[model samples]
Target: MNEIDPFKLFLELQLALPRNAPGSARATREAFSLLPALPPRPEIADLGCGQGAEAFELLRLANGRITAVDLFEPFLEKLAERAEREGVPETRLRVLRGDMNDLPFHDGEFDLIWSEGAIYLLGFEEGLRLWRRFLKPGGFAVLSELTWLTDAPSPEAAVFWEDAYPGMGSVASNGEAAARAGYRLIGRIVLPTEEWWQDYYMPMRAKLAGMRRTYGELPVFDEMEREICLFERHADEYGYVFYALRRD
Candidate 1:
């Protein structure tokens, strides 16, 4: 069996679905709601800005310049295309491909860091510590992470993410970790319910049906079909926790 490409799995899922990127509705609302009012012209970084969903949202909120960073070349390409289509200047939207775990930037480089459904790519606690250094004093980090509601997850869930996301933890534990990491808690919210799953899985299932017709049994089609099933099975129980953290 060819090893599954988890990143690709996420990419297809999101590209095929939603106005925002994947994950909980409540989480996106929470993160956006918690944003500190930008300066007259604040500089912001959208870490892991896959396909520029959150970046576009921030552009609306900040009305300021944005640097959208992602590791995937394809997503960055799409982001560039989006910039042109949306009439956002190439200069106004800067796209960079970089490692999230080892961010390449000087300390205090940005006023705000917008991360949605990405911190779990690295260990959540580890991201809390390392990414903090990138923020200026009193700078903000608005992020959403996969959070467990139950301290002990269902056996199926535990098994699912253990293979998928080993770093997953409950919202309370993550909040405690952020506090310990020296970030003042500005705000937090549990992701919204219906908008979360419908946004991704519903459209993805549609895409899979389309691909199945076009390709007539290709490997990619099969992979997406399986992913669609998984989402249908578990989306209700899984959710994200959104947090707005500030440097103390």
Candidate 2:
């Protein structure tokens, strides 16, 4: 049996997010519904786009142009391929390999910026502050992030994210940080229960099974299986927070 790579385990978890599921597509659409009144055509950028799922949707709605950005090279390759296959024009779709901490675009370059479940990769507050300059005046930024409904998180969940995302914060705290960073909160949504976990976990358990068969004794698989169980146990304490913000 081959050894299970921890990085592979993490990738499996990320790929399983609800944003990638059919039911959760509505959430992504709902998040975009908060855009400012503008012309039918607008420029949009999807920050930390894993494989362009949300970016594709934005392109359809904006009827203008979309730029997808990510740090991972392979994911960007897949995104580009998907775009081409979808009949999106080479001119209309642009993919960039860049860091979200310091976006490569000039100030006020995009009319709308979309980030789905990716802010935790960078500290939430820092990402809000750092990426604000990239938005056009009155431009809106939409993001989905993990947050706690209660002030306190379970010990297990807290410990999990502490290592996975050291800079995460609660929804209230994240909202305050957005305000401090000069973004007006236009809207916010707390995800419902089934919308969050079932979309991701069902696919993930299958993947884990496949991995276990391929890599029999790998300890990483055991670790990931345990984490999934814990996430199930604490499903009600936290959720994905979708926020719409405009430059103040």
Question: What is the C-alpha lDDT profile of model 1 across 1-248, one tens digit per residue?
Answer: 57656566556656656543465434455577786676777788888888877787777777678899888887888889889898998566899999998888899888888888888877777887888888888999888887877776667767877777777777778888888887988888777655555666577777777756744556766655664565567655567767888988
Candidate 2, TM-score vs. the true structure?
Answer: 0.89
The 10-residue segment with the lowest total lDDT in model 2: 14-23
Tens-digit lDDT track of model 2 for 1-248:
56556886666655644344222667777877876675577778888888777788777677878888988776787788888788888678899999888787889988888898888778677788888888888888888888777767889888887787667777888889899989999998876766755566677777778877756647777776776687678867777789899988
Candidate 2: regions farther than 4 A off: 1-5, 8-23
User: What is the Å distance of residue 121 in model 1 from its true position?
Assistant: 1.1
TM-score per model over all chains: 0.84, 0.89
In candidate 1, position 80 carries an lDDT of 91
